[model samples]
Target: MKITVVGAGAIGGFLACKLFAAGHDISVIARGATLHVIREQGLRLHTGNDLVIAPLRATSEPKELGIQDVVIFAVKAPALPAAVDAAKALIGQQTLVIPALNGLPWWYFLKSNSALSGTRLKAVDPDGMIERSVPTDAIIGCVVFPSCRVESPGVVRHMSGSKIVFGEPGGGSSSRISEVADVFLRAGFDAHAHENIREEIWLKLLGNACFNPVSLLVSCATDEMIDDPNLNTLFVEMMSELLELGNRLGISPKIDPLQRIAITRKLGKVKTSMLQDVEGHKHVEIEAILGALISVADLAGAPMARTRTVYALARMRAKTLGLLPE
Candidate 1:
């Protein structure tokens, strides 16, 4: 399969390297230092005790790569709009687009059979540019569970977790979903083709909606946040509000707030991706992680007073740090 991974950041670099190693033709859409590094020394991955290098095609222009069999979007939420715009030329009629992103995707409500079907999430796709550019039939919902970080411009360090779930946007089985899962499985990931990918997305968002923004507010790691009594209470309240909103949308996650928190606590002193972005002076995913949830809550008529409060504070913090527009 010919694959092109956008961003060439943490998740993008990791997947590109693994897929390339598995004998798939791989290319990357990147810019600035990342593009230069990959072109000069190839994309690198640090997993376990081995450092593997996969020399593949690397370019900033999507048209240069032409149409790909599969295009994986691994960019951060804030960069997604521009990334999608730039990568439009990479999607052919038979192309499969898998967005391995955190938080709510722009296509979440596109084919969703719930009352909110066709509702556009302004938090992620404020201008509907992504919706107009990418075809709905080409999208395969994906939830990535791996924790990875960019060790350098062209290098990605795999920390832990390898589970990647794929499913059709409208739910049910499909050959495309299974094909994508098989591709990941060949690369040594714990990949699955789920019947309901939205449920898996909501389950992951249960932790992201709470941990990511709060970590930005408090400057604490996962274990530290879970250990603090006051913050722990806040997490429970925010998560409960999200639970109600999900239920209203007909998404009933198997785990509760406490169980989810416990699972995160077991991950030890893990720094969330939002915190990493803040510390690195990069843009955090405030809109996608928190703002999107609040939008759904409003649509579902669920009160998210506590979550709204945290979101406002976190948004202000990001703006203050120059990570967001004023």
Candidate 2:
């Protein structure tokens, strides 16, 4: 199937290399030095043991790729709004727009079964720009559980995990979702189709909403942050509030917060995506990870005092670092 990756960083490069090697027609929309490197040498993937280079059509202009069967947007949250026009260029009438992003997405509640459906998370999509630009029918909800990083321009390092879940907003199973999962499976991902991916989204958010910002603020890795008594206590409080808010929002996950935290602590000495952003001086996903949750919590009439505290602190830090508007 014809596919286009909107961003060629980290997750995007990982999937692109695998998919391209698998003989799929892959096109990457990238810019500047990264684009130049990929265009000249192809995208490179180092899966810890194996190094693979994928020959792909790389261009900063989305129109060059034309319509695609699937357009995977792997952009950072803050850059998503500006990415709309490019994303639209590759989206045909029957195309699928899968946003493989962190935290909560703007399309989360677009047409879901949740009571939160139709409610706008302005934190993620200010003024409903995404809603207006991308049609609801074309949106396919995606949640990724992999840990990937860009080692350098055109070089992606896959640390671990490869579970990518896809779900249609209208609920239930669809042949289109199965097809998408098949492509991921072919690319060596543990892919699954979910009737309700929101549950998985919430489960993942439990750790990210807390740990990512905390790590950025303290300039520490996950192990060092969780090792501190004060940090551990704060983490528990944040998870508890998220659980409360998630339940109110109809997100039911079998795993509890403590179990989730235990799983994360096991990873040890890892830097979160947000911390990576801070170190790279790139825009952090504050609104996508925390601001969106706060908006939903308010909609659910759920108390999120602890979560709100973290959000406020993180936003301040982001502004101070020039990661967010003053």
Candidate 3:
């Protein structure tokens, strides 16, 4: 399969290297030092215990690569609009666009079976740019679980999980989902197809919604925040609102919020992606991870008082640090 990874960050690097090693024609779109390093030295991925270096084609401009069979949209939320615009070069008639992003995606309610049907999340995809650029029919909802980080400019470290769940948004268990899963399976990871991708999305969002903001606000690890009585209560309250909202949205999450929080608390010293963004002084995913949820709550006519308070604090922290626009 011909694949183009858009972000070329930790998860993108991992996917590119692994898929390249598995005999897929992998093209990565990157910028700055990361692009330079990948072009010069290929991609170095350290799975903690093992290491693999796979040569791949790297370019900043997507037009340089031409069309691909699949374009993995692994970019951050803030970069989605630009990424979608650039990704047009790689989208052909049969091209599949897989978005491996976090939180509530732009197409969450399109054709969904919910009262919030036809809702558009401006927090994630403001101004309908993504919907305009990437049509809903070409989209395959992807839920990624690879815990990776950029060890250096061109190198990535795969920390824990290496699984991804994907499905068609309109509830058809199509061959495309299995095709993508086969790619990942051949690359030596757990990949599965789902009928209800929204459930998986919300299941992942439940943990990220609470833990991510708390980490950014307190600058503490997941276990530390989970161990704190005050933080635990705060997180549970936030989860309660999410659960209620999910109920209203017709997505009865398989795992309840408290059980999910308990499972996360046991992970011990794991730093969330949000905390990493804060420490690196990069633009955090505050709006996508937190603000979007608040928007969902408001749209669902659900109460999110606790999440609102946390969003205010987290957004304020980002604003104070100048990571967010005032």
Candidate 4:
């Protein structure tokens, strides 16, 4: 399958390298240092003791890369508008545009049948910019369950887990989803097509909404935040709020908080992607991780006071540090 992965960050690099290694025609839409490094040094991925390189064709201009069978949008939430605009050239009529992103995807409730179906989240989309940019029929939402980071430009390091759940917005299995899952499974991923991908997304977001903001506010690593009494209390409160919101929407991943915490603690001192953005003076994904949930909580009539408070604190910190727009 010919595929293009937008954003050369950790998740993008990881999936691009692996898919290329599996003999798929891989292209990357990247800019700046990342484009240079991938062309010169190749896209390198470090998995445990092994370091693999991908001889991929990468260019900053999307027009250079023609229509593809699949286009994975793995960019952070803030870059979606511009990213989708650039990726417009890759979307053929039958092209599958999989959004393997963080938090709540902008396309979550676009054509969904949930209680919140067709609801556009302004916190993330901001006046439906992304909605108008990407076609709704082509989107297949993905839940990425991995912890990886870009160790440096053109290099991605996988820390733990490698499962990606794919599902259509209308729910249940489809031929396209099965085909996509087969492609990913061949690329050496624990990939599967879920009947209800939204639940999986919520499960992933539960930890992110809690851990990412707590990491940002306290300036602590994942394990450190889980260990601190006051921060841990905040963590629980934020997670509780997210779960309640998910439940009210009739979508909750079947996982206990203790199990989720155990999974996070296993990573041990890992800096969340948001925390890393804060440290590196880049824009953090406050909207996708926290703001979107708050917006939905209001629509769903779920009590998300704690989540809102956390979102406000984190957003303020990002603004004060000049990491986010005022």
Candidate 3's C-alpha runs over 4 A off are: none
Error of 3 at 222 (Å): 0.8
What's the lDDT for candidate 1? 0.91
lDDT of 2 by residue, 1-326 (tens): 89998899998898888888888999998999999999889899999689998878999999878889988888998888878866788888998989888989887887777677777788888889888888889988888888888889899998878889988876788998898898889878899999888887888898899999888789998889888989988898889888888777777778776788888888767789999899898989988899888888888888788889888998999999999832
TM-score of each: 0.98, 0.97, 0.97, 0.97
* Per-model lDDT: 0.91, 0.86, 0.86, 0.87
RMSD of each: 1.1, 1.3, 1.2, 1.2
Expressed as tens digits, the lDDT of each residue in 1-326 for candidate 4 is 88999988999999999999999999999899999999999999999898889979999999898999999998988888889988898998888899988888888887778788888888888888778777889988798888888888899998888899999877888998898888999999999999888888889988998999878888888988888887777767777777777778888778777777778888787889999898878889998888888888888888778888888888998889898843
Best of the candidates, TM-score: 1
Q: Which is the leading candidate under lDDT? A: 1
Instruction: Give Cα distance to truth, residue 193, candidate 1, Å.
Output: 0.6
- Report residue 75 deviation for candidate 4 (angstroms): 0.8
Per model, how many backbone clashes are there?
A: 0, 0, 0, 0
Question: Can you give the lDDT of residue 84 in candidate 1?
Answer: 96
